[model samples]
Target: MKHDEFIRRVSERAHVSAEQADTLGRAVLQTLAERITGGEADDLAAQLPPELQEPLRRPRKAPADPFGLDEFLRRVGERAGVDGELALRGTRAVLHTLRDTLPHKEFEDMVSQLPTEYRELLRVDHDEFVQKVARRAHVSVDQAQTLTRAVLQALAERISGGAAQDLAAQLPPELREPLQRPRDAHAEPIGLEEMLSRVGEGAGVDEDLARRAFRAVLLTVRDAVPRKEFEHVLGQLPKEVAKLL
Candidate 1:
């Protein structure tokens, strides 16, 4: 509760708009990102006073179950160290899309091909949902069902209703809060090489924009990559960096 509230508050602060909250989130996400990245956490906390600290603390919790619709989707994300709730929303969206377009047969087929490890996580209901969709799509029962489930989950993540908020609710407050206060966000801490690599790779950026973006990350709550980049590194570059002086 506290952690969630603190994030909400951080988004609300005069100095830290909602978009900037996301910047704070990125900067303080990893331990190495904090220590090695250099004062990333301190920079974020600078905007938030001690008074805001208490609210960002939530209780520790296990990620949601894998069988449940919302929880199951959440669990999938948990594997990636992401909160399940947020993940579910995406799943939900994909499901919504499947219901609207993809035939049941295609949905089932997709699931059958899922890695062996995936079978252990499903429930009868989810299976049934796939089965039904499979029949409608007029394809292999097993294969179509899987596809339907996959399609739904994929779509839900992009819908963006409350993915972050829902995920935050599932996490322990301390773990979540500390994520907000990474010790250093600008230095590109060593351990985060993979994370940074993933981001750059996923974004298809070839160069090392990590540090430049890291500096701007502390300024956005909206996740507007370009805008925030301009705001911190570009907008105030001369004044904030002071190389000229």
Candidate 2:
């Protein structure tokens, strides 16, 4: 793809301006180049637009710098003059766009060199989260969006404040907002039926739809969060409700 299109895609995905996208994309590519081998970086540079190629090409003579995702994001944030959160979002956007545009084997080869924690950058974003809910619940994206908010709001209310904050940390910004709202220090211990009723009321849907949406949201959350964190969340719930997750 052309440079403009590449930047545009990153901007849209990251919800940033074109100038910001350019800065962030270059930051990520530069950091990525440092992480991968010189030869692999050259291969990656060859596939990208000429404008973006330089960042990847610069470090081709140096040995790969071994680092985890947190360190990678830190470097990207430092380079881009942005905070860690924006750096994470921008990196995901650039990488996701790269995955969409690059040859499958090329993308796979590059990712293969990285550690498992690096792969977590490709985890569900807001769009993917909504799409999963829509697909699983057999609803439209609009309806799924509503259902997602409803269920998550109810979930935030039911779980302890710490658990809710931890869960929010794993999700994309849009989905994270609802869970970040103020709540009690301890879990509310609301029953499954009550949670469903709250979801139904919040979403303006009936009982069946509410149940389906609740299940869909929880299932997505299960995949989105770490097993230990999710277990912590489940521990706050009754057996009947925890089983749904």
Candidate 3:
């Protein structure tokens, strides 16, 4: 998805404003880059959106050092200007999204390079994915699935046409439909509120709950697409929408 759309989605999921999502997303991604080997970081960077890739590419001030999950959360929290708890939540949100977007082996290889504790932080199963969203959104598993489908469809609309198609290609068959759904190319851009409304309508939930679900899916899409294409997607959005990214 586009950068603005991606941030807006994360903001909804993380229960933060767009600006806060931007801050948290960058912090989590940058800190993650520092924790892993340069080659591994580069490999992961190759798969991220343009606005997010730089965090993984910039030279680290110090060599990567071995660290546990607590230290990882502390560093990310410090950089994100949030407490450790909030940082940990944001990191999980980002990582879980990564798990969904990447191919299984690609995701596994990146996780393999990390310390053992890192594995638990990054790894997620299908049941866990559904359960986490259900808990956070206060919705049933069935509702969460509906929400997930709606959010992915909405995201496909915001991403550029070519990028959207590429994203569909990457997703599993179960997810490809939402990403490949047809949308009007010349339609006027809508703000987060409208997006949430559509998600609510599609998921058979209220706007408040839909917002939560929207964020959950959007955060993942942000890290899933190529950064350059994501930047282009951001540029095409309205100013109000762009501010969110």
Q: Give stretches of model 2 more than 4 Å off.
A: 1-116, 181-184
Query: Which candidate comes out best when scored by lDDT?
Result: 2
Clashes of each: 52, 0, 6
lDDT per residue (tens digit) for residues 103-162 in model 1: 333433433333334333322233344444444444465544333333222212222323
lDDT of 3 by residue, 1-245 (tens): 45676676567656788888888888887887888777777777777678878888845344565777898899888898899778877887777666655664566677766776664554344455555567667778887778878977776676666656666654445666877744444433677787878888887888778877876654444444444444565565455544543
User: Any runs in candidate 1 off by more than 4 Å, and if so which?
Assistant: 1-6, 9-36, 51-245
* TM-score for candidate 3, residues paired by index: 0.49
Q: Please tell me which model should have the higher lDDT, number 1 or number 2.
A: 2
Residues 117-221 of candidate 2 have per-residue lDDT tens digits of 876877778888888799888899999999999999998888888889988988888998878855557778789999999999999999999999999888777
- Model 2 TM-score relative to the real fold: 0.54
Question: Lowest summed lDDT over 10 consecutive residues: which window, candidate 3?
Answer: 218-227
Output the worst ten-in-a-row residue range by lDDT, candidate 1: 219-228
Q: Sort all candidates by lDDT, best to worst.
A: 2, 3, 1
Better of 1 and 2 by TM-score: 2
Q: What RMSD, rounded to one decimal, does every model reach? A: 22.6, 8.5, 13.2
Please estimate how well model 1 matches the true structure, expressed as its whole-model Cα lDDT: 0.33
Residue 114 lDDT, candidate 2, scale 0-100? 90
